[model samples]
Target: MSKTTIIDKEAARQIREGMKADCTKCFSLCCTALNIVASSDFSINKPAGTPCLNLQPNYSCQIHSQLRDKGFKGCTVFDCLGAGQVVSQVTFKGQSWRGNPEIGKKMFQVFPIMEQLHEMIAYVSEALSYEIPEDIADKLSIQLKKLQYLTELDADDLLALDLIMYRFSLNELLTIASNFVREKAISKLPGNRNIKDFDHARVDWIGKKLEGKDLRASDFRGAYLIASDMRNSDLREVNFIGADLRDVNLGGADLSTSMFLTQMQINSAKGNEMTRLPIYIQKPSHW
Candidate 1:
């Protein structure tokens, strides 16, 4: 692994906390800024810049509790990644689009940009929390600070920001962080699988029965694991970055040491009481 600045536990915790969504301070930006397509995930089609019909006067979703039950599963899965509060409070000084109709369009446009920046901060903060080498940790820490500074920018500054360059820089750092853990994982795998083409590394096991399988150190990044039966499987140290776990069966699955498994992903998945998880993540009330 490469050498980088090491961010201590306290600093990492602060970063993570800032990236959490505080909806009480937000103006229902997600419910307004983004468009929703009519599908299994959503009950109705909503155009961008318009509030959903269920949005209450106080910016609360009227059907929030029954989103999944009423065919708006996407709303349940959606997270603003702390963007909503930042834009509502910092950028606009607690102003709402309704109060200032002229800024409504611009606010909607900036919401998505802020969302991307905040998401990167979330990923970068998670990477920094790992026990990596000093040099790599240092680099991650530097990048984390940069993203944090970006989040504090004013609306005009944020709107003028070059997102493409920032993404390239952040992705490079994250890829390095990912590879550091992946290399360690691969080294621990048994010799039964082919070195050139490991089935665990590239298999499309979506909707497949992988119950009780030894999937240690496998790379499931960006793979479609939707509806896969993974009961009692050994997912120790597996890379779950970008993996889709929506409706995936995780009954009795061991994901206690899985990497990059976010709370959003876990909340969207179908897990039972027996499914083990990382100590830091809280189990969903519905599960």
Candidate 2:
């Protein structure tokens, strides 16, 4: 991995664009297929395949504008990665589950499968965008195509697919991609900040107080940084692919150059307007 091949900035933009949720084009599959629990983030316990209480007749959330204030903050953080619309419009041909009860259960089952495929596409796209060796990039591209192809399958085919196998293959590619980006980040750092200081594979900084630390070019792939204090941290070129960011403090943290930090992760974390985010994520009004 070389600095010249660190195309994550552009690659992140492309993946985010492709995965951006378009509620208008979707049948609100997430509000129906997924289960919700009563917690700090949710207001009630909803079973799988059951429509949410706040779901409207038009397949939209009635309280979409006030989800957080109404104790549905979890809803705000969750992303279907464009699978909701793909399942609703593409797989089902715009035939919603509302009037068709027979296909409703099937749709519920397929929605999650499609969501998983879309999630893989998101990560695989990022992996392909990294600056790795040509052989690895070619392999990643093949995996990416396979994941994308799965998203285009019909309900029965999608349900019959072996997700565990696909996941295993994708995980192998993701490991390669994660390592490539992390090594590239480390190469850009000064001599004193060596690679040994940071955890590359699965850094465990959970609940650690790392405020204002110089964490430039650190590998945070699948790192557990939940509830960690990272305020004003120098996170330039840090690879954040698959990192747990829930409740992670990012006040004044310079993440403008961070790699693979998605909008969903940013929304879940505790950040102020002063937090330096990548160009793709808008500054939340709550911040």
Which structure among the candidates has the greatest lDDT?
A: 2
- List model 2 lDDT by residue over 1-287, tens digit each: 44444334366448655777788988888898998989998989999999999998988788988999999998888877788889988999988898888789989999999987877777777666557777677666677667777788888999999999988887776766666766677777677555656665477778999999998877787899999999999988787878999999999999987777777788889988789987656666656
* Tens digits of per-residue lDDT for model 1, 117-168: 8877877777777767677778778877788898788788999999999888
lDDT of each prediction vs. the true structure? 0.80, 0.80
lDDT of prediction 1: 0.80
Candidate 2 worst ten-residue window by lDDT: 1-10
The true-versus-predicted C-alpha distance at residue 171 of model 1, in Å, is 2.5
User: What lDDT does candidate 2 reach at residue 87?
Assistant: 91
Pairs clashing within candidate 2: none
